[model samples]
Structures are given as structure tokens and as C-alpha cells.
Target: MQRVVEEISLKAWPAFETINHRGWLMRFANGYTKRANSVTVLDEIGLDIEEKITYCESQYRARKQNPIFCLLSFTNPEVLDERLATRGYQLIEPSLVMGITLSERSLNILPIINQETLNDWLVAYHKLKALAEQPSSTHHMILAGIQSEILFVSFKQNEEIVACGIGVLESGCLGIFDLVTSPMQRRRGYATAIIQGLLQWGIDKGAYFSYIQVVKANIPACNLYEKLGYEPIYEYWYRVGSNSGNEK
Candidate 1:
């Protein structure tokens, strides 16, 4: 089950390009999400773990990224984990990968939204996340490059956008990303409405399951997702250092 969920995650946020290094997959997407930029090793490899780490570090350096990192889950090889620990890799950004089996729901195909809607979504995300004004180039490239069917759904109050989400449908599953609500408008049903809209699209496509990634410390999101039937299948934390990197 863990392996299956990890595979779904990889498919959901595939890198724009990838490199295979000694059984480890190095995904690069202009540093959009750590998942796309970090190393993922799901299978056992032939090289010594320390040597493999050295190789990955050199590769990321070539790409001008520091603090080489890896996506580590329980399904990853134990020997690799020990090697990273021995080398002083510290974990950060622990996150829960939650999933649910989709059921029927209400939805409209939601016409391909205009750029304004996309703008609103980014604003909400940046505000909630305390990021600077959203940069259109990197973020837009990441969002628009997804090959799976997707929709940008939002909730409006008095003609202003208050909540938004990105729904992706791939291989019988829907992966929800960037679900955000204006801080002032939260505690209303706006977030839930956006989720329902995305799920409905997935149900229409005959998807059997859905998944979302939330920071482990986010209590409100965990509560909401729990209410919606999503459960944490696995927990992963990034091991970060100048010598190594943590989960992305």
C-alpha cells in the first residue's frame, strides 16, 4: 500500500524532466516542489549508499542546487536511511500524504478559468503561506505543465475570489494541490466547496481514489481532510544539510 501511494504521488507531480542515477530518480522542475527537485529512491540500488549519496550530491551541484536531498519514506531502503543519518542529514518539512477513495459528488466541468482566476488563486496561496507576491514564470510553468486533466476551482464572495484549489486526474485517481482560502474568509464553507467541486470532476472521470499532501503541523487541514475520509498512509521528512537534503 505504501509503494502504491508513493507511485501515485510521483505520477501526480511528475518532473518536467528526469535523470536516473544508480536506481535513484533525480527529478528536476526548476525547483517548483521539492518532490520535483529532490531525489527519490524507491528501489534498492547496487552502489554503496555513501557512494550513491556522493554521486547525487555532485549531480545536484552540477545543476546549481545545494544541500542535496532525498524523499524518504518507510518504503525506502533502511540501509540508505542509516547512511544518511551517519552522515548528519537532518530531517525537515515532515508531511503527511493522505488519500481517500472517491465517491459521488456535485460538480460542473468548470470552464477553463481565466488568468484572473489563476491570479486570485496565487494571491490567496501566497498570503496564506506568507510568501512574497507570487512569481508567474516558475509557478505558472509548474502548474500549466501538468499532463493530467486539471481544473482551477475557486469560491467567490461578492465577486472576489476567496478560496481556490488545483484538481488533477490521473490513472483512476485525483490529486488535490494548492487548496487555499483567503485567511479572512476561512471558517466559512468556501474551502469545502472547492474540494467538492474537484472531487465531482474526479468522480465523473470514474476515479476510485483521491490524495492530498499537507504539512504535518497544519491542524485545520488535517481535521478537514479527516472529516472527508482521507487518512495518512505514510509520513516522510526531509533530511537536510550541506551534506544532504530532506524529503521534498
Candidate 2:
């Protein structure tokens, strides 16, 4: 069922798109989509890696102008470090593609946030992005179309907003994104709570399954998803490369 849902959703909108970065090709897509296309990075001196990195940065920056660059990732590509050497774009922490099954666990529906609580939710989101090295924006306008949808955030015992998550209902499934907890707030099962909340919310909306993406090397996250009743269906590689005047 989950596989079928993913296939239909992908076909409808093509969760990810590929871009050329001057001889290097990269995948740039909405992070909420959970699709990592591919990226390939190769080193060349005269072309200047810094220039290429700048161009790539500009591409996303331009995307932000349209309110679409809220979240994105540069995935696994050959010779990434080698190409970034000249650009000084330091590699950030790796991520894993993790998910959960809606059929295997009992979920609880948390209360919705009121206008007063919306500010608090935004703060929590900002903190999570800070920890994850993600870009920041209060693009509530972008979410205007989704006002009827529910956004869930789970707090710790001290109300420190430890774990934050969101779910988008499409067809018969829920796509989860922005699941993060503070480093100091780890090991309190907050992640699990949020997942349960999101799953329950999806089921309430008549969803058939839940899906999310995590870096392959994130052992803790992977284990957590497995414990929550998620199993692997397919794995895709991310490759980034600088553009070399190729149109395709």
C-alpha cells in the first residue's frame, strides 16, 4: 500500500528535479517531497569551484524569492569533497531517509495550535532549523493554502519544544517532514511521540501510510523508525556535479 501511494504521489508531481551546475549536475527539490534525484561533483581548476558553488547557492536563493526554497538537500554524489575543496563550502552533517508504517502502531491525536500557540510553534521550528543548519523564514504566507491542515508539535516535560514535525496529507497517505529535536533534548522519546502524533493525524484524515526521508548513515534515526514499525522499500542515490555548459 505504501509503495503504491509513493508511486502515485511521485508521478503526480515528480517530487524532485535535476539542475546543471556547470559540468556538475545536482538535484534540487522541495525537501518536503523526500526525493533525492542525483548530484555529481568533479574538480576542475580553471572553472573555479567557488564560482560553481556560488552559482548553486544563487539557484536556491532565487528559489527562495518564490517562497520555494524553505528546505533543500544536496545528496550523495561522487567526488563531493574534492569539488568543494576550492569553494570552501564545508560539508554539513549527513542525514538518513527514515519512515514509519501507519498500520502497525496506535497513535494519539494531539490538540491543534491556536493563533497564540502559533508563535510558539514557529519558535520551535526556528530552533530545530538552527540545530539542523537549515534556512529560516517566517513564510506563513506559503502555508496559507494549508490552513485547513493540522501541524503538530510535541513538547518535552519542561515545555522546551524538544521534537517538532509536520505532516502533509495527499491522496491516501501522509508525508512527514521537519522532524527534529534539540541535541540537549535527546533520549526523551520526543521523536517517537511526534511520529505517533503525525501518524494518528494522518489516519484521522483517512491516510493509508506515512513516509519520511532520512540520511542513510543516521543509525539512531534508522533504528527509531524501525522500532516505530517502518521498513525499507527502496533506496535512491544523490549525486551533485558542477555544470559544464551542458543544457541537459
What is the clash count for each candidate, in the order shown?
6, 28
Q: Write the per-residue lDDT of candidate 1 for residues 1-248, one digit (tens) a residue.
A: 66676777777677777778777787777767777778788665446767778877777767776544666566555666667767777767888989988666544445332223556566656665656765556776777677778777767777776777888888888889888888778888777777777777789888888889888999999999998788987777665556234422
- Residue pairs that clash (backbone atoms under 3 angstroms), model 1: 68-245, 69-245, 238-246, 238-247, 239-245, 239-246
Looking at candidate 1, the ten consecutive residues that score lowest on lDDT are 107-116
Could you estimate the TM-score for every candidate? 0.84, 0.56
Candidate 2 whole-model C-alpha lDDT, 0 to 1: 0.52
Q: Per-residue lDDT of 97-179 in model 2, one digit per residue for the tens?
A: 34554564346456432222445666677776664643334233233334235464655655456678766677766766667
Candidate 1: C-alpha lDDT: 0.73
